[model samples]
Target chain A: MPDAGPPGRRPRAAPAGRAASLRRQLFFWLLPVAGVALFVSALADYLVARDAASQAHDQGLLDAATTYAERVQLSPQGVPRDMPAVAQRMLLAEPDDRVFFRLVDANGIVAAGGAGLPDDLPDGSAEAPAFFDLGEGQQRLRGVAMRFEAGGRPFRLAVATTTRKRDRLMAEVLLGMAVPEALVFMMTGLLLAFGIRRGLAPIAPLRREIARRSHSDLDPLDMAPVPEEIRPVVAEINDLFARLDRALRAQRDFVADAAHQLRTPVAGLLAQVEAAERAAAARPLGAAELAGVAATARRLSRLVAQLLALARAEPGAPLPMEDLDLAEVVREGAEEWLPRAFAHDVDIQFDLARTPLTGSRIALREMLANLVDNAMRHGGPGGRIRIGCHPADGEARIVVEDAGPGIAPGDRERVLERFCRLPGAHPDGSGLGLAIVRAVVARHGGDIRLGESALGGLAVDIRLPAPAP
Target chain B: MRDARLLLIEDDQALADGLSRSLRQDGCQVAAAVTAAEAKALVGSRAFDVIVLDLGLPDGDGREVLAHLQQLGKDTPVLVLSARDGLDERVGLLDLGADDYVVKPAAVDEIRARVRAMLRRRRARTGQTVTLGRLTLDPQARRAYVDAEPLTLTARELAALEFLAARADRIVTKDDLLAGLYGGDRDVSENAVEKLISRIRARVEPAGVQLRVVRGLGYYLQTGDA
Candidate 1:
């Protein structure tokens, strides 16, 4: 399932203040980037320095080799002759860079050049040129030998210079090019880290704001002064809080109203009994007084009972949820209500799907009971009632239908309100059954709707969440 | 006449006045308190046979009065009266030791019946058991026997059976059944209790004990041998 969510993702709801979080985020994001940049810069500098040093070595060798090839001339016998001392002066004008020169004949002998040439060197003519390094103690020379034709004969010329001196010069040039880059790399990384930390400093205030709240505080978050990047999430969280606050308030009010309403009947009864006892002690009670007191008290008891049942359907109230066979629940609820229906001449029948569901079995029954109760109260005598449950797709559906006075389309929703007994309906009801049913349905995360029944009475269709395997 | 001392704790003046007149005619010395505080004062000051305590009072709750009365060690049976019929409130007061309870707008007779039941319960713990039809109950023994054979009943089962037997043949809704069974600490649905009843019926009906459930109203244990 996509692993629930990204394991290291930031929480969906970030606090309003982003300073501290931003600072942390800056540290999180910029540290690696700065490190990468520093590494890349260092690599580029190293590569460039290595290439420059190699080029310097090759160029210096080529320069010395070119001087020897250009100055040495071949005699009639193919012997290479050195230039006059004047030409050598011009060539050796740059004294720090020492140069060596040699010329050899076909016999591989030093015909005219200096004794620096190695006798066993490999042979080559005109177009072929080669470079080799010669080591003498701690000193090394890079030599380039090339063959040339003069006066109809072949002659070879070789030039050599100390590689150590070349390398030292190349090293100085490379260091000059690399020093600034390395310093800049280090500085940039440190600066980036500091900038990231500074940028993310606001998040700490946001975290504090969130951590300071109590669970009961559902007020909207104070989003002012939050960074623009984080405002949307804060707004969404605050909106959720606002909604939750309203829902909680409604629930509290509902309970309070229920408690307040139900207490009236019980209180009335107490008051009446006190009156009756005192009246009997002082003088004999009249028939009217006795009947009035007795009838009201009975109604009070019935009302209290109904109110209590409705309250039990409230959220967080105990409705022992169990894995139940839906068909069985319907059957049992039907059987229990059968006698009452029979007394009222209401024919109650059931057609069930036998689908097992997960819910408070009691709540399911109460929901059924209320439906049956409503049918009896409004459907009047001789009304026929039908109960059915069926499994469709991935959900279970339960329907209760009656063959009498179905509710009007407009009033169907209204009747679910507490104490909203229909106008001109039977007075015996406590006016909370449907409300209780709705509450129970809501608690079970089910949906309930009233419509015209097949029997021409009310039909309550409830769909509950599919049971887990 | 006027020898029975009746303590009246009610918040409503009109209802209180009417009840005072009715109880006077019923032959009792009536002391009416307007609030729970007043009721407390009355309880501290005088003794009465029955205390009709209202659950909703101006200064304090009627359940508080019931608790205080219980703390006093006085055996005065209290009948809690409240306009609210939520099972929790009724069960709470009852659990707190109020002997009986009646919802508001009650007929004086229901008040008298509850009061009488409490008085009767207080006078003797011997008649704890109740019998209706083929069902036999031993309230003190906390046992029920059907057809002379002992039927094992849990405390709740016994209370349900007892409640049904007490009002034998009359309709008792699921809400009242729950209130009478679990009281205030646990808020159980009528359907859950009905299931319990169903299970109880499954257990008790095998022995020819008939516990019939009325669809909309509640269950009834008929007073017939069959």
Candidate 2:
């Protein structure tokens, strides 16, 4: 009965078009992280080296300011006596820089340099030479202003220079340190990308292996060359394929069995029709002969119909589930089969309680219909068939009893297989009736038991579990 | 387009043979293909009025052929024959451009009627009417009249009359009427169709159309004047 998959469930196989590519995923995540790390460390290196380089340049400016102030000979009135251009030239040794120096008395009047500089420059505290950055944008400058005892008056000597050299040195240090690491980082990036691709090379064959397979190929994949990490997934996939294969084989077997079961009836119907045709050709067919041919044809029709029901109710086939009353299904089935029962001269009774169960309505009805058909066929003439349904202790129960010849106790289970019939069973039985009933019962997670009927014949009892609320 | 041409795509040789023979009897020219490749080749090479397809083909799932047909933008009707009792496959195949579907182990008469119905739809003409004797029925409008007097009937009763009237004077079997009345894949019992015919027969009796039963064969619809 588990041929179509457990009613309403098929094993979950990973779907197509979602093939996971580890190479691309790894590269996408790794490259950005590496780039960010390189940029951060390079920025840190640039900041530290630039601070060291700025200190050396500020010290050089301080030395030049001190030497230049020493050369200024000021009279006792705190005014410069002589301003030599050679001393200033010696101080401004680097000609690329625009340098300015100012010696001013405590009154803050520039004595020997340009007065365009701000007048509110802080009188640095009397300790060591003070260094500060003046005006940062388009002409960046660093200034060191100090107070020196010249001409017995506290004379403030200030030296300012454009930071052209320091800026160049900062770039040099950053480029010197960061460029090599950036190159190495890029190389490592390339290596990592290549490694990822090489690491995922096994998947190409795995994909090709799966792709190259025929649609019906259900064999397990060869595990030899699979990567260790992906082998487990392959194993799981192969296992899923194995389970699906079993279900498929069971379905194929059911079809094959169905076909084999139909072969005899089809051949019989064909032979009967052909014989009738030949007999009619020779002499007009008699009523008795026509009746015989019609009887076979009708049986053939019944067999095919029952076979279809059996396949539909296949225990493994996943028909959808719905909330339905077992009592209602029984009532409907009784109504549907009432005419057939009448033709077979059987009286049927209904004792239905409002029993609810979760199952495929079609499957359940087919089960009940098969039971009724079997009862009608085997119950013989002037027999009574009793049908009952009720909920008992969380399970729904269905019982059909007839006053015909009951199956022997040992033969009960054997009669549930396809094309099985008791030795003295009704000649018209296709043997698919009980088989379909068993399949349907199994699919609904129910149990079917055969017992002696209180009606002096066979009693078929079934119990199906009610779905959770 | 002169006559209905059908392509029967089935892996089961016996079913293919049986169905093709029966369809030919119903005045159709059937071309049988036993594999997916063969079916695809035939479908590509020739235009069929209707294609009877089985989903469980040996070479591949028949849905591939359905996709191929769709990709080619051919609107030829396809009726999928499937052994799968699953509802998903049925709904999926239908959604994938199969016009209709039938579960396997189907009656041959039912398959033929489905093909016939599909072909009729392909050649549909609006406002067409059918008349036999005093009985005139417009199937599209679901209306019937007798000698210029209107006859009111239920949907099922009118449908049964339309099917029988289409094959007038010919013996249409019970299975034929069942297939034609409820469609190919509907799981209706023979008793229902029998009861429906009796009810229609009563309604049509006074309309001058006779629904006669031939024992062991089926009912024959003809004019009472005949």
Candidate 3:
């Protein structure tokens, strides 16, 4: 109704592919969060498992060192010796680890076993055993060292073992903890998908409802059990249906009226022809006897043309725009109505300047033709009419002013409506000219202003925006 | 078939039947085709004086026929009949070599006039001059002379007079005169055409040529000898 102005600038009613579109949005928003949660939980599990394994491995190493120190014995010359192998094996009981033990006396002599071992053992007192990690290239070992009395001499003993079992325990913990979390994550993802699908379940029914309807069935869509989020959308669609129903109804009524309008003249034509044939038996038929038929036929032709022009001028179905000089369009108007004005005893004066308009040539022609016709109709006998197109504020200004009885300012708007004629106006008009003109001007997104002309009748001024350079 | 053979290509049966009946009553053979295919077959079968083509044919648009006619180099005058009142459609059809177009619910007389006009124009295009009484109209020269005396008339008077003279003894509707002179796109009224005829009539009536007015139909130019 508002000239379908800036068709491309209109906002979309709703986003397309609604359900899949929402899923895509949710996936982008939520997947990263779910992934981070999985990573954090897995990291916590690995850290706890590694800490517990290190503590347990260190405690076992200390116990093995203490037991070796306790079983020391003098070997005839008071050299400290380890306890029996079977007793040492009983104390160092670890299935997946290799154990080492060494006892060093204050004289720097190995009394037990220190063969091929690193010499960086921590010096310790009897009160506390020092547990430390020893690096053997890439492989790591945990060791415990303590000072103890052996064969009535103070000696330092250290026991060490590789961390292969501790690492295996941590790997077991990582897998054991992550599997359930991952399963839960997958379950949550599936549930989310199910929930989204369930939320959008109404779409299929809506589609089916729409598809099942006949073309003429313009009833509002059923909103039963529609999701709350989509209520506004369905309501909007229903509103559109209501508007369409009204428009169609109005169109049907108009067609009925137009049909009647057409029948009047056509019936008159047939009757006149029949009468003329009848008159052939009496007196010869001529223009005087067939005046009604001729007049109606001509009226019918103009009415048909006007009706078609009105239909063409509707803004809903827009014509493609083209760049043309406004001066050319004005000349077309002049060409159409100059003779008409002359016949009406009106003086048509043209004050021309070059102005550019980007519009459908036919539509602008219709608009200007109407303006000229309106002037010729209401410009009174012997009135002077002035028409022009000039540039103003980067817009094309087209105007028609006539020296006749102009309408009061209040009635200017009413005159533009369809079938609206002023009291005591000429009967020759179909009252559609201005309506078609307004429709065309509206479609072009141009402005129409009706005011008092300097020539004393009506001044119809139109301004259309200039196209891009 | 009569000498003036007309082919009507219209999808609407009622309108087609009515138009064909009226045209047939007017002493012309009217061939009514209900579809584009039928119309196409009918057109190629024999030459028609004029083709009243409806653009909204069931099988296809009538423009196809226009294209087909052009391709075949058949200069048969086509008068497009359409419910579409769009100027672009009318202009586009005319540009496609259609002689003219008439929007429907058109009066029977209007269609008859258009057919006659198209046929006349077609004849005129073949370099023919028309004679009514002693007044002879040379279309090529665009001149009119009454019994060897060249009449002094404006360009518009000559146009109106030429249209009337071509259909002498037959009625020419005022609407037809308006169309013939000013064309279909203009806003000139019937009064304008009437005024032109009277002015031309003032000069030609004394030259033994008589243009009789039928109020509903229009002027019938009768030769003094007739």
TM-score of chain B of each: 0.54, 0.58, 0.62
RMSD of 3: 10.0
Write down the TM-score of every candidate.
Answer: 0.58, 0.57, 0.67
Q: Candidate 2 residues A383-416, lDDT tens each?
A: 8888888898899999999988888899999999
Q: Write the per-residue lDDT of candidate 2 for residues B96-195, one digit (tens) a residue.
A: 8997666666667556655655554444322346555577788777798887888899988877777776555455767788778778546788788788
| DockQ of each two-chain model | 0.06, 0.06, 0.09
lDDT of each structure? 0.70, 0.77, 0.75
- Give me the runs in candidate 3 sitting further than 4 Å from their true place: A1-39, A66-78, A84-92, A106-109, A121-130, A134-140, A146-156, A164-179, A186-246, A249-253, A256-283, B1-226
**Which consecutive 10 residues in model 3 chain A have the weakest lDDT in total?**
A1-10
The positional error of residue B34 in candidate 2, measured at the CA in angstroms, is 28
Q: How many residue pairs clash in each candidate?
A: 74, 8, 6
Better of 1 and 2 by lDDT: 2
Error of 2 at A171 (Å): 4.4
Better of 2 and 3 by lDDT: 2
